[model samples]
Structures are given as C-alpha cells and as structure tokens.
Target: MIEFDHVSKHYPGGNEALTNLSLEIRHGELLVLAGHSGAGKSTLLKLIAALEAPTAGRVLVNGLDVGRMRRSQVPYLRRSLGLVMQEHRLLMDRTVFDNVMLPLTISSQPPSDAAKRVRVALERVGLAEFENAMPITLSGGEQQRVAIARAIVNRPSILIADEPTAHLDPAYAREIAALFRSFHAAGVTLILATHDDTLYSPYGARRVELAHGKLLS
Candidate 1:
C-alpha cells in the first residue's frame, strides 16, 4: 500500500509542485493519475518512488515512511518498484538483453539466474527475438517494450509508468496500455500517470485527477 498524508512538494525558487495531497493506493489496484500537464502527477509518482522528498507531510509505502528512510535503505525500497518513465533512459550503446539485465547486475545476482530472468522479461514484453539487438536500432514502440522489460526484469511488486505512450502512435499506445493491463491482472499494483484519458478510461481503473497541485476529484 502507498499513502500520502498532507503531502506537498516545493522545488527550488519556491515553486510548489504538489500541495497537501492525501491519498491511498491499495495493493493490486490500478490507479490512473489523470490531468493536464503540470498537475503534479509525476511528482506524486516520484514521492512514492522516494526519488523526491515531500516538502511537508509524509509519504509511505507498505508502512515504511519514504521520507524518513536512510540512504542505504533506498535501494531496497526501489527494488520493490518497477518504474517506466516518459524517457526510455536506455543505454543506447548496450544490447537489449544487457539493458534488461542492469538491475540484477547492480544487485549482484548470479549470471545464470540473471540471464534467465532477462529472457523471461523480454518474452513477457514480446521482445524475446530482439534481445541481441541494440535499443538504438529498434522502432519507438519496440524500444518502449525494451524499457518495460527492463523495468519488470526484477519482478517488482509495483509498476509506475509516467507518460509511457506519449511518443507512440495510436496503435502502439494501445499495445502498451494492454501490456500494463496484463501486469495488473497478474496482481502487480499499477500507478500510471498520463494525460491521455481515452487510453485508460475503457479499462475502468480508478481515476485520480489533479489540477494546480491539488486533487480535483
């Protein structure tokens, strides 16, 4: 479970990205953060990931206070989350398999085990045949699939996507949305931040709308 209690995020130069935001995301729920740009959707996601600290109030994940965790504890917290950002953030120089193997490599998992997990992740994202391919050589949608595979390679309990389909065509966008649904159905908690309401509305996920740093719905 994730909870935000009177959370507010203020950036440098006194810019407030979120304001007294309070909400709870239960495990296994598919929650969509929908709003126009600058609605604090990304900030909210970051808070949950512990990538950013709240300026006020508290953010908790599974009863652990994110803002209070020690630096050494951050990695363990992140290991439980699979994050997919708007940017692919791939190592353009690396093979798709290598990119997907990164998280396991950082954790120092055994090579054989990492390889098996990497293959399973690639297969889940329909990129099994492209493992040896370079991310730079793939199409936009395919590259996004590689990113998704990389995110899930560790088999995280929660998946957070930030505008994952922003750069894709309609067909590719739908494909990515279906991919998320499959993960959700398999019991991975999902929190997706996107401005494209049409893409997620049909799935009937709970919608949390934000406007000017505050919850609008």
Candidate 2:
C-alpha cells in the first residue's frame, strides 16, 4: 500500500538522500530495504513513515499523497502505521505497560480498552509478564521486543522497522526477525531497513538495494 514515484530528497545543504527512487510495496508484503550506512535506507523509511517530505516527486500511502496531506492529518496517517527504530525509544521512567499504553492513550481511547490492547500487544511480542517491569531492567532483545510491542499495540495496518536488530546478538537478532515474520503472517504490511545480509537473504522478500541515495534495483 506504499508507493514512491520518482521521489527524491535533498537536505537543506543540498545533500541528496534519495534520487528519483520509484518503488511499490504491496499490502501484506514483506519488503526489505538493504544497503550500507548513508545509502539512503533510513531516508527512504522516514519518507514512507511520513516523517519527512520529499524534495521532489511523490510518496503515497493507500493512494493518499503523503507530501500533500494537511499537517493536521499526519497523526491520523501515523496512527495507521507502526514504526520500530534501531534504538529502543522507550520512556526511561515508565513501565513497559505505560509505554505500550502511550499510543492508545494519545489517541484518546478509553483506559479500559487501552489496557486490553496493551495486554494483547505485549503477549504478541512475548512480553506479557513484563508488563509491570521497568524498561531499564530488560535485556537488549527484550527492550527491542518492547519497542515492537509499543509499535503494534495500536494494530496498525503498516509496520516499518529501521535496523530493528542492530544491537542484539545473533540469537536475539534472529528472534526479532522471526517476530517480524510473525507480524507479516498476520497481514501487517512490513518494510524493514537493514545492512544485515543474513537477515534479508534467507527471507526471499522483495529486495531493494540503495547506494549513495539511488536505488540499485
């Protein structure tokens, strides 16, 4: 449900981040964006997530032009998508339950409903019993799972992960990859950006390679 047509992104100082990159990510498909650092992988993800507007051309989600959408509609677009980052961007002071509750709470869902959703999300990420646990007490793998739980807690239609397995050991990295697969199986449109060949090579997903801001395709 994501489309990029002749899209290009140029920073204020004129560094090109994407160059006429055209791609289509189908609904329920697991697409992997693979490349080295500074290869525009993250830039592409940010554009799809609606976190950054392209300098030229278009980015569409479900046929809605992301760059042309009203600023007020951003929250609505974002709420429909789940984003997992390389770093675990959890609130240091909050419990895992509260962190997962943030999305539902921000969307103004009732407390009772948010609690139920949080429980399900944690369970999906294999973190059900860690609800009351502090984020600081968790291992890197656990923290990453918590991040994933927080992302999908809202049941988003699209899930984007940027280097989701960066910090973990090989075992945990595989664990996180499997979790992504599980989400894909459940029909969440998935896009993951990574430099790890082992993770993407074996998956047989549609692969897009980027180098110096251009799709090598």
Which model scores highest in lDDT?
1
- In model 2, pairs of residues that clash are none
Which runs of model 2 end up more than 4 angstroms from their true locations? none
- lDDT of candidate 2 at residue 197, scale 0 to 100: 55
What is the RMSD, in Å, between candidate 2 and the native fold over all Cα? 0.9
Predictions: Cα RMSD each: 0.8, 0.9
Candidate 2's residue-wise lDDT over 117-152, tens digit each? 999999999999999999999999999999999999
Best by TM-score: 1
What C-alpha lDDT does candidate 1 achieve relative to the native structure?
0.94
Worst 10 residues of 2 by lDDT: 197-206
Writing each residue's lDDT as its tens digit, candidate 1 over 64-173 gives 99998998999999988999999989999999999999999998999999999999999999999999999999999999999999999999999999999999999999
Backbone clash count for every predicted candidate, in the order shown = 0, 0
List the candidate 1 regions with Cα displacement exceeding 4 Å. none
Residue 184 lDDT, candidate 1, scale 0-100: 93
